[model samples]
Target: MKRFLTTGCAAATAIAMTASASVAARTLDPTKAEDALEISKRVQCGVADGVPAVYHWSGKVYSRVEGEPDRHLFNGEGMNIRQCVKITDPKRGTGYRQVSREVMFYLDPETNEVLRTWENPWTGETVKVMHIANDPVNSRPNYPYSEDGKPHQISTLRRQGKWLFMPFEVPLFYHNVLAGDYQDYVGNKYHAMEIFDFAMLADEMLDTKNPTAYPTVSWVRISDWMPWMKMRGRQGQMVFNAMGAKLKSYDELPKVIKDEIALNHPEYNKPPPGDDPRPNETTWTVFKKMVDKEREAAKNNK
Candidate 1:
């Protein structure tokens, strides 16, 4: 069996910086529709320019059945680390860019142990499992000004001096047919729908000098059963509610989680390099591809 796991806000305070000084501050304006883009960006990253930050998240999954109430499924923990670097000098560049990487793993609900291996009840086959998924390096534009961009500007205009938190919803749907040989285990085609609801907030005032002070985010996901569980066309969905906060260092993670990362994927022990250029990919998409590849290999071997 093949398995894979995949998976901001603003505030105000002392007027140390203004819109002209910070690109994030200048881009915000609740009254203007165009500022929505800036708000989205700032909520995900931060208002500051050229500073790195890390985030830690822990949550649980629930299995929802139509007639019966939802039951606990499993626990999950992950980390996302981003490096925002500023490009100075017209010859080299004159803007800010960010490189980010994330990883997530599923664990036993009761034991809180990472689920590394499992035995298939149907085939009695022992399976090596990897419930974790690592995101590809993602690069995006960053905020440069302190008060000019959306982060700072929105704090005063949008939230009206209160804490700023934004809600967003994302829907995903995709289907693909298995290529060859391994079609017997997994049906010919795979289909699923996932809806994500997110709330983003900032713990402190948006400031350019403090790029490490980024937004904290929480989300809930409603989706089809994970493919690796091999529900065999079962009818049900999974619900996940998780909250994440920026961390000062990797050592801040739980000892168990840190040990797992060191043992299985040591490369992720630290955040990705600032220069990494790989683009992010969806977990579902990657999982389907891996399943198909394994099935094809099995077919060819026979």
Candidate 2:
């Protein structure tokens, strides 16, 4: 099993210096389990009737090798912007929807440049890709609200005015053609597990004075190497440590990132549609799908 590390002292100090007076004024009773859950919900998921928010995150991915110290793989940065909106349709049950769009960038180790285009060894095809995701499914268990149109029940432990560390495991499957003749090609399935440790500030979420002043959250994830790296049969996992804070405006994004987006993917610079369909696709899934489709089209033409 992978181990999750808590936020470093440096990060904690930074938060302390920048935290609002309202945040610093509140006192936490670690023994209050119910309060912990309520705080966790507010930090992880927005409260009912709350405004939409955006979070910006940047971090490094390391290759964790057995018996050897982790090796630096690449840098990553992304944005997750989401909103909770009312849905009048009764059949939906929840009567509210959380629409979101997530985008990630894998940067070159030395130059920190985004790898937007590359050549595929399997098919020798030039590929242009971006890492963006959207999830339109019902809210998760820990979210502030549930699919049944009810609020989440508080059921976790508390520590220092925040919920005790929680663990989340996500299983992902990737399908592709490893190798085969055009007419004899078959799909190959790969499995990976992603685990995360989540924690956040309870006071910020509970603050009604500033609904838009979202709480800060910190997390770490351990998972397999991104398939886009094309490390075929590689032997290592990636460890990602990142911290997120709610953004008041898109302009708050790092100037470097903003410039990059303007030059490379200007379309994504704008906020996502509120009612757009959920995007459950992954980088590997989409790549394999496209490759298979192209091959099939070629075979049919011949």
Candidate 3:
């Protein structure tokens, strides 16, 4: 199981001196749970209430190894279609559930074409590329109250002029499905960090006139080399940095992404149904499933 950590103190410390009460002082209340829920809804999905939205982000993936200069591994394009469902809990209060699916495709560094295979410069071996096509990356219903009956506040917030900056730092640490159970004794574990900074207009979030807030987003990721890379427990990591925004429509994605999704993954063009019930998929889990399928096929043929 992977753990996700976020501390309001850390984020507040970083921008406490800069955050000021924007014009939203008269409208949105940063302290209230209902208002905090509104802020999150606007930044993560939309304020349109029950409407689906699409987020398109693109960036380059890199290789970072000890005693070696960083190398650009591939250019990646990603898109996620999501929607928030309003849920009311008499005991827990008002909240929402975010349901969505996302996909990220790795491209050739120079040509920018979707990569099918890659030659690992470090290991000197060719390996098939497995692009990210995770589905049902949904979130639990978020309430204004914590489990202990405390108010759950969005910790990382900044208000500057007309822009509200909300930075979310998510650090992940957990068991690596591909690694041996002996990992408890050894030291192999899956670890990664993802930072998402969303910038939006305070007015759009507060004013009922605006159906949604189209916030610009910056996404940064640090993690171990993807399993598909065949790193074999190599000493290195992967870094991804990209900028994007909540687009007005899903068709607005890059042509390459649009065409790719249309051909093989047309399902990604829309958000999962509001009542979708399925387990979330991760790269490791998907990779394990693929490996298991191949093994079963080989055994059957024998």
Each candidate: what lDDT?
Answer: 0.59, 0.56, 0.85
Judged by lDDT relative to the true structure, which candidate is superior, 1 or 3?
3
Mind giving the per-residue lDDT tens digits that candidate 3 earns over 1-302? Answer: 12222466666765764354323244768888777877777776755656788999999999999999999999999998998888888877888889999999999989999999999998999999999999889998888886677886888887898888899899998899988888779978889999999888877766644556899899999999899999887898999999999998877889999999998798888888777889898999899999999999999999
- lDDT-wise, the better of 1 and 2 is 1
TM-score of 3: 0.88
Which residue segments of model 3 deviate by more than 4 Å?
A: 1-26
lDDT of 1 by residue, 1-302 (tens): 12222110122222324543554543244444334434444544533543456777889988887788787867989877676655543332244566776677888789998887655444475665656565655766533333334232333323434366555565654344323456556544334443323333333433323433445667677877665666665667888878877666677887777887788777776556667766665565667779879999999999
| Model 1 residue 192 lDDT score | 40
Candidate 2 local distance difference test against the native: 0.56
User: How large an RMSD does model 3 have?
Assistant: 12.8
Ranking by lDDT: 3, 1, 2
Give the least accurate 10-residue stretch of model 1, judged by summed lDDT: 1-10
Given candidate 3, what's the lDDT at residue 238?
94
Q: What is the overall TM-score of model 1 with all chains considered together?
A: 0.65
